[model samples]
Target chain A: MEQARPQVDLEAALAASERRFRLLADQAPVIIWRAGPDKQCDWFNKPWLDFTGRTLEQELGYGWAEGIHPDDHARCLEIYTTAFAARERFTMDYRLRRHDGVYRWIRDNGAPYYDDDGSFLGYFGSGIDVTDHVETELSLRRALSQADQYDQQQKQAQWRQEMLIHELNHRVKNTLATIQSIAMQSFRAGVDVRSGLAKFEGRLVTLSRAHDVLTQSNWLAAPLDEIVQSGIEPFRTPEDDAFTIEGPPVCLPPKMALSLAMGIHELCTNALRFGALSARGGTVRIDWQVTGDGEGEQLELTWREAGGPPVHSPGQRGFGTRLIESGLAREFGGKVTLDFAPGGLVCRVHAPLPAEEPPLVGGLVVPHH
Target chain B: MGRRVLVVEDESLVALLLEDMLLELGFTVVDVASRLETGMSAAEQAAFDVAVLDVNLGGETRSFPIADLLRRRGIPFVFATGHDPSSLERTYPDAPVVRKPFLRGDLRNALARALAG
Candidate 1:
């Protein structure tokens, strides 16, 4: 009875120990293994064999190299060789062939083992798949570099184009000035229609003055001060302080500058030939003011002639009259009234200045960095 | 010293015209030079009763530098320009200006006004 009791207790202890080891290996996610000296595979868990899809005998010894990528075999072998010689741990990340013949990145870790006497014996290891993570990291780096290169190229192209445009504008301005100078000299050679020569020179001068404003403002909108001054430039005389100029500090857009220039030119020509600007001591007062209406915006301008010959409407709408009315009103989204006031000619122009915007040419917004 | 005047005009013809007009008005001509650089240089180095300047010279439209020099030297100058007066008036409110192709009397009047101011 006593002998039978001892046998039962031993059997119970053995069963409990076996169950604990099995639970540890089966429940754990990591694939684990053990081996003997001479790099022999003495033991491996179910997961190690399952991940490799190989039988125990097929994976014995260095047969596990079959799962290692062909390219990684030499480097991995060198690492293991060093470890075995030094009796140290061997751990690395490498591509391992999967069950389906595809290569996947795996976290491979192992440590050389020794007997109780410290002599080299064998090794054990764990592995985990990391193929997707490594691939994503590599692809992201490539995409980032490509974007950087494309942005750099676009910026360089934009700079070159701007320089070319500025150069072209400068050359055009110079040519126009030269033409005006030659024409004036030729007109002096023989003054047939002094009026006609004056008119031609006036136009060229207007264009030249406008170009000056554009250049000074750096191809941006022309200031109202500049436009008014430039318009009256060719007509100002020593004691002929005929035009009293006034306006708020406003920047006229390019389109508005052209139309307003032509209008001012007509006014100047008319003033010289007929209006208050025609006679000695004749004066023209010019002014503009801005005010916001219920709708959006409004500009009121007054061109009043103080001293001149008897005022009379030409009894016909010549280019000058129509120009002052229609041209000034066109696209102004506003109105204008020219009163041939018997005392002096008075022109009242009303326009709704458009809202200002950030400077940009064409569809591009200065191109983000 | 009769009203001595310095004429700084780029065009030789314009300069001669101004000189003749000044002589006729009993004013002695002190000097005449083209370009603002030389004009300012002359203004700095010489003493003058008054200066006459052509506003536009080889693309530079601003006479502020010459004006500054004259202002510092306490000498009055008038602008002789074919262009308009608004530009100059904005910069120099009290400075007198005489447009080109003028009557002999117009320059005389402008010179008198500038010297008086």
Candidate 2:
């Protein structure tokens, strides 16, 4: 009788404890949930309405899955089913649309409960909002990848600049070597030193000017008139008299422009030093004509120096003379002839210009005209 | 005399200097092809005891494309370059290289080493 009385008292105390726990759960902001062994929500605390903003009927059974984002609902359900079938705790975080239609992440945690016979009875669960934490993690990963890609691109640009520096150094050395040989031979032959130096400086400046024009297009090509003007512009003076340039605006390939510019430079320097362009009223007229089609096309150029002094042939064949005749001729694939008439100095150069590269998109891409 | 030779150099002075050295060595001079696309093809078409080739033509290194073709045809050709030897070593490791601004004897020795090796 004493043992049985103690047992009843213990049972009453346990019931009181259970009531207190349920009451506390009803007061909390987070929802306490219970489901049957069939995986259906059978009990929900008072806070369930506040969390889901649903009537009792809508908050019961599998109705809670309605608030989940459509994209995540199927995947969440699949995982939930797998966990439930394996009789394990199911915990997942996913977006659920609120009553205000704003999607927010939720952390849903639940553990399977069993009967005395070890058979599944139902489940005990709780849910909390975790949207801020999830968004922070994803945004952090994206920032890391962006920074990594930026570093890689910076490294590539640095390598490209180093290579360019090396190429520029090599090109400058070769230019100096050619110029040195010319100066040495001129000094050895006892040409007028001052005039020779002036000739050298003038030639270099012409070459430099042509290079500057091509550099604007990244060493690609410069227009025919651009090459001619740069070669003769320095001698053009203000006093209402300057060089005349008239040519078809054709872009010359790098090799042809380089050689032709140097050749033109030699002729202009000679004129500035002694020929038709030396005196006060000197002027040069330039023009070019292109004929044929495709790879067969050829360009004929005429440079006439007038209005200064009469033309006369140089006494000896100098480097400038050779360069004008041979260098331009070889590069141009045509002939160059000088007409040293008593009236003026005239030069005609002919060469086959390279074909232009095709456009990226096919067809005769006529611009909006 | 066992054989004759041909020299193909673009620089006129260098060509004259090479011709004088070849004559002193008792080898008959044949021909000189200065420009590319013509130089190596001239070699393949003609027969010479040994040929001296300049690797750069008008600032082009496509000289190797023709040289490689000549080597494949079983001609013993040597390279005489104003450029660096280490730069040419990658493509022409087995081919003999003589740097420019060389002495008269340097050409004869290089020609002999090329023929012998």
Candidate 3:
């Protein structure tokens, strides 16, 4: 009778402990689940059933697998089965279908549950939705990549700016050297120092005028007529029919325009001193045309003076003469002929026309074929 | 007759001044070339004791190639540039460089040093 009484008390105590466990599991906020040794879900807390909207019977055993996303089912089952067989702790992330027919990301953490006697009972696992967290991480990664690309573009722009500045500095120094050379040559060649200074200033002004035209064209080609006009306009007067210029529309490269402008300036200076423009009824005629076809195309220009003092070839060649003759010839890769006929000082230039659409100074940005 | 010198400068006024300076220094100016191709041809065809080369030609061409040809012909040449000397030293370590707008005495000294070498 005494042994029977103790057995009854033990049964009651076990029942009370089980009741307490059920109450605690039901009230838990997390989706708690228990799987048997066979790696099949045996029991789920109230939260789990509420999340999946499934009956206890439908959620038991392998029936719970229906809630897992088709894409994640195999991997999810593999992780659970492997952990169960080894009786090890495991954690994984997967997509699971909710009550609203939406697949949400969840992180599941499982551990081997043990009995009081140190024997493995089953796996106890808990899962939490991590959909928002995962999406935030993906967007952050994309933003970081975009920022990296923007940084690379900024660096490239900075490098280009530095290169342009360096080129500008080199050009400025070169211009200074050119000015020094002009001053030195002028002073050495001049019989009168003041006259040399005037000539030097005139040459500098001519170069400046050419630069202005080039700048207006964005350092591209300059019109030949505009260049001639710029050089001769200053020397024209109301009473003088001294200049007669006629030329077809011809676009000259920057270097060519600059050299030609200087050449024309020299011609005008000479005309004023001893050529056609020196006399009252004197006149100078300038004409040019494009000749030939295809690859043999050439630009032919003529400067003729008449109705002035009887033209005489000078015994000595001055800077003006040398610049107009040899300078233009070398620059254009052409021939220049000077004919000091008793009538007038006649000059003719034959040069190859530049290839169609020659590249401008800043046109190096385009890749060549 | 004086020592004949070749001047390879792209700028006309600069070349003219150089010619005058060379004449003043008792050197006969042989030829002046304003482009790389012209300079190369002049170097091959002309008779000159020494050459003055502008390092940068401001376009796609540089005078280094001409300098290389001069080297092969056993001709002494000096570099003139508006750039920093150290930048050019790596390529032409032994070549003397005269900065642009140089004094006549400086150019003469550089040329003399080049000839002596």
Query: Model 1, DockQ value?
Result: 0.01
Q: List DockQ, one per candidate, in order.
A: 0.01, 0.12, 0.49
lDDT of 3 by residue, A1-369 (tens): 977998999999999998998899888777889987777789999988988988989989988889999998999889888878888899998887889999888888999988899887889999888999988988999999999999999997787676666656666777787688668756774359998898788888888888888778776678989898877876789775578888889887776677678778888888889988888888889999999887777889898999979988988776665665545677557787778988999888787776754442222332123
> What tens digits encode model 2's per-residue C-alpha lDDT throughout A257-359?
6557766776777787777677876677778889888768888988888876767787776555556554456434578888887778888888777676322
lDDT of 3 at B75: 94
Best by TM-score: 3
Clashing pairs in 1: A37-A121, A233-B83, A233-B84, A242-A284
Query: Each candidate's lDDT (Cα)?
Result: 0.71, 0.70, 0.82
Worst 10 residues of 1 chain A by lDDT: A360-369
lDDT of 1 by residue, A1-369 (tens): 987998999999889887888678756787777767776677767777788888878888888887888889889888877876677787877887767788888876888766689877778777778788888888888988898888989988888577456444434443443343334433543467776576666766775787678667765578877887888888888664777888888877654564566567768888888889889888889999988964666778888897899899877654344444533454445577788999888888887776773343422234233
Residue pairs whose backbone atoms clash in candidate 2: none
Better of 1 and 3 by lDDT: 3
lDDT score for residue A73 of model 3: 95
lDDT of 2 by residue, B1-117 (tens): 645675666543344445555777777777766566567667678777777776654332336655766687766667776556787778777777876655557777777887886
